[model samples]
Target: DMTQAASTGGMMEMPRASRGQAHLKLAEFAAKQLRGETRVASFSLNGWDTHSRQKRNLGAALERLSGCILALKQGVGPAVWDKTAVVAMTEFGRTVRENGTGGTDHGTGGTMVLAGGAIRGGRVYGRWPGLEEATLYNRRDLMPTGDVREVCAWIMRGITGTGISDLETKVFPGMQMAQDPGFLR
Candidate 1:
């Protein structure tokens, strides 16, 4: 139905011609999982390495990401949206300050965006380490205030009804998930 829906005059234009089709594919895959055809799915968005003119370069990436989110939500429909949880995360972050080349270097501390009817929206649940030069990691990167695994463990524990002990010990070995920043509703 997406091809037919796309034929409507009111549909949004593709942020980037090449990548837009992939967003549609993401929506299709999500629909399959919602219909009990799959248990899980994942997708990747490219072009985060902005080594020059970050304002311009990063916009395209963000737009494509947004496009994917919109397509997924629309494809799933409101009936299934209430049960979904879309977690968008980056493996790592970039430097706090722009580098000499008008871009950022790879560093620690990125973001994880959790969306859908299941998430507790409008709240940024993380310890904020201010932008003071001394507060930065190695004087270049934002200090990582929250453990990524803790968030992961929290989500898994909620979904599986698993105990904290198993989640911390078995699910994530050697990692003790202390703080539970509840992102799930």
Candidate 2:
């Protein structure tokens, strides 16, 4: 019944055939949100390893990510999308410099993508740690100029009205909430 489940729940009507299974599921989740059945959804897309052939491998992964975001927006409709915040983050970063294999090794600083109408879109946030060799972390990775947790804290504060004390003590332990970056509308 797994296949049946995948094709059900508003999946068959997905406008884009190129979307993968994960994107279909995300679209279904967005439909549920539109119906007030749920307020949150979480899913993951794999194939981001990119130990080599980064240009081709990473490009494909990014295409799938773009499709997933589009599916979410299309499923939710304009009204719900205006209240949605889609946060995409990787657990780890890659080295600033390419390696001998034409790929990057695991490193420190990574990028987080925020989309949807709920976000303060069209602007990149965070301090720029230049790619200069001297500014690299341990001379290997990009130096983390800001904590990812702080950005998430501010988003949580904006979306849910969560207080700073709880964000520090409970939600994101050991994180010192910094100045609000106004990530959300």
Assess every candidate by TM-score. Answer: 0.82, 0.85
lDDT of 1 at 147: 70
lDDT of 2 by residue, 137-179 (tens): 9999989888888887887788778999999999999999877
lDDT of each: 0.72, 0.78
Clash numbers, per candidate: 0, 0
**Residue 52 lDDT in candidate 1:** 75
Give candidate 2 regions above 4 Å deviation: 1-20, 30-34
Which ten residues in a row are the worst by lDDT in model 1?
1-10
Model 2 scores a TM of 0.85
